[model samples]
Target: MKKKTFNVLLLSVLLSAFTIACTKDIDFNQIDDFEVTPVIESSLIFLDEPANQFLEDGVEISSVQDSVLVEIFKDAFIKEHLVKAEFVFETTNSINRGIELRIDFLTDSNIQLHSFSFAVEASSTNTPTIFNYTEVFENNTLESLFETGKLLFTLNLKPGPVINENTPGSIKLKSKGIFFLNIDNTL
Candidate 1:
């Protein structure tokens, strides 16, 4: 009887210890931050690379004889491609000095001119065409910049004083690219 009692007691103690040890199954993987991290960051802008795009029609002065040569070809190419202008010249009562010439330009991204026109080469006659041009220029009294990359301007064809030295003064001014002409801001 005594032995049986002792054995039973020992068995019971052992069972208890085993149960206690088995109940805890925690091993959280030594988690300090607990995983789940997602943070990434990596980030440039300065521009002026417009080499040329606004040369829609810069030097259009087929040819003019007088009226200050249309204010000197509107001060060389449509008054610097003004933000306003619409002149359509056409005179032939006897050609006292004013032939047909059309203009409609308003350049500089604001975009207003799609295809302006201008030509007058008839100092006496003989210029069906060939003084290519667009219109718009800058530099008045200093500091003019029509993008200043190169949109040259100026069409000085004079027969205005009625001179006869060849009188057929043909005006000219082609533009597409390249500038820096007659550096005089009208000063």
Candidate 2:
């Protein structure tokens, strides 16, 4: 009976100590200063065209053009949070002709806002030649980027050996966009 009484008193003391434990005050306002910077990478464009695609009826087609919708800019949240953007392009050519690429940023009503161009050298051997280019948008350009609704790409072939239906090489292009965002709760 004495041992049982001692065990009950020990349990009561432990419970009482836990109930009276002290805790420091917490400041919920600290969350107002929290901020986050995030980087996002996404594939923007790709193309693989056989040499013969540049020829039609034994005549070389000097240029070919295409466009894609920039859907991410349609989001208001993305526009507000985005601080910078970068576009990376890689092109590999196995054809015997150098090429020039023209890129244009346009709005919903087909108004051009910005344009840039780059050139890719021709490959002399069966091994393909690779070219890389990067375009960055920030500060004053960021506002124009937010207004972009579409991108136009034009590929122009340089004069060289003629390519026919039986040509043995192709030109390939791959590109991506990197986005930088700053999100602050205080905003």
Candidate 3:
């Protein structure tokens, strides 16, 4: 009986040791696999979104400003509508910023001449000094450049530099405060 009890005790101890030996703790620090890809959307089905509008003397318009109205539709611009002109300058004298112009259409019976004039007054802002043009706006010191009655800075602006030293940014305009001739039908 003593021997059998000793044998049973030994067997129990050995089984416990075996179980403890089988138990283990494991640790991991690395993921097994991974992948990456880029997303692209080319469907032209978006709601009214702001265009990255910009202006330049001669470059991409997107490099100018944000949400410019005058650029997309200059020829068909209406009166009382506000718009922005763009300027891209890689030089020290940069006047390509904040060039705001107002448009007014005249009609004989409802139309002005195809050729109307405008005025360009120097704003209280830090406008660069305008140099020489006509005897009227010469001396390069336009304390009030350039004044005409009817319009503000108007003279056939297409693409490219509007004025230079010789032209002096002429304010093609009428002497009277009102530039557009409202044609009365009583001829």
Candidate 4:
């Protein structure tokens, strides 16, 4: 009787151990990425002619003015699995000319959600400069915007304090941007 009882106990222990070990399998999550490029004409900045200021009918003024509104990719970029997002601005003409650049994310009502600025000095002589700006929306900022389809990108160019008042040099800044996004298993 003693031997039989010992065998039964040993079998039970082995079965429990095997079951527990099998249950501890590894869990993997999926990731998705979205990227896009926005258009902005640096040559059009600080145009002195009136003809350059006005746009044709049915044309969007955001393209020619000091600010440009960017359209976001709503279908692919969701908030559920968003791990990180970044905007990288690169240009070869980032000369230190006291030029101020403002980038903002806006709502449908033209409300500012988030913004950042970059300044170039006057002393800089056509050196390649890049601005890698990262913005993480707080309190479901991105989630709600995505739901309402009100997300927008606004870029503004301003003259810095050190800029010459009499003859401010024309800043032809051609810039490009890449959006880096990390999404979770929702891919």
Winning model by lDDT: 2
| Arranged by TM-score, best first | 2, 4, 1, 3
**Could you give candidate 4's per-residue lDDT for residues 103-178 as a string of tens digits?**
5556556676666666544435444444333344434565543543233333333333332223223444444432
Question: lDDT scores for all predictions?
Answer: 0.32, 0.90, 0.27, 0.43
**RMSD of each candidate?**
25.9, 4.5, 25.7, 13.8
Name the runs in model 3 displaced over 4 angstroms: 1-105, 113-115, 118-158, 161-187
lDDT per residue for candidate 3 within 1-187, as digits (tens), equals: 9999999999999999998886555544223232222222122111121111221443334222111112222222211121211111111112332232323222323233222222233423334423221112223322122221221222222243433332222211212111111122222
lDDT score, candidate 4 = 0.43
Best of the two (3, 4) by lDDT: 4
Report the C-alpha lDDT of model 1 over 50-137, residue by residue, as the tens digit: 1111112443333422211111233544233333222222222111133344432323332332333454444334333333333433
Q: Write one digit per residue (lDDT tens) for candidate 2, span 1-114.
A: 999999999999999999898977899998998899999999988999889888778888989999999878768899889999999999999988899999999999989999
The weakest ten consecutive residues by lDDT in model 1 span 42-51
TM-scores of the candidates in the order shown: 0.17, 0.84, 0.16, 0.40
TM-score: model 4 vs. ground truth: 0.40
